[model samples]
Target: MGGQVPSKLTEKFDPHRLVMRGTQAYQPRCIALEGSVGVTTRCSIHPQRPSICREVLPSWESGEPYPQCDKARIAHGLSPLAPEDWIRFKDANASAA
Candidate 1:
């Protein structure tokens, strides 16, 4: 929706729906054909992001990381968090909080 739509999908896809109604009722679209996900995986509209986005917390605070974050890291060849990592993360952020 932000960039030029692929010619192949032009006939079958509705770019408007992908861009305007991609996220509905708290469900987010994967492709972000909406352009909400930025190049670095941060929300493009972070300052004005939805309530659900604001409610998500990293593992350190919640005691368990988001499964999707862990899955993505593993898919990219990174290790999942060890107990020590969580301990350190909690220690580091505890003071900030």
Candidate 2:
């Protein structure tokens, strides 16, 4: 997670101290602190970091290779990969595991 103060972790909650993790990625995509952008606090707000951070595949694409899948989509000069394409791309690369 993004070192946020989880409800379970801290009795007193300070949203500011909470560093937003994965889902938090949607939160403006801008960290306020100038120098410490990537550094996450010790106490995480959510036990589960955002999907983007954890690189969790979407429901449709359970075990896809994100980078390869993403690159392939871009190589064609196409838009972002759709969920179904991601699923297929991931599955095709599964044997490489």
lDDT of each: 0.49, 0.43
lDDT of 1: 0.49
TM-score of 1: 0.36
Best by TM-score: 1
lDDT of 2 by residue, 1-97 (tens): 3443343422222755433323244333322223332233231322444333455333336544466546534644555446776657668799778
CA RMSD of all predictions:
9.8, 10.6
Per-residue C-alpha lDDT of model 1 across residues 48-89, encoded as one tens digit per residue: 444444555554446666765666556556776556777786
TM-score of each: 0.36, 0.25
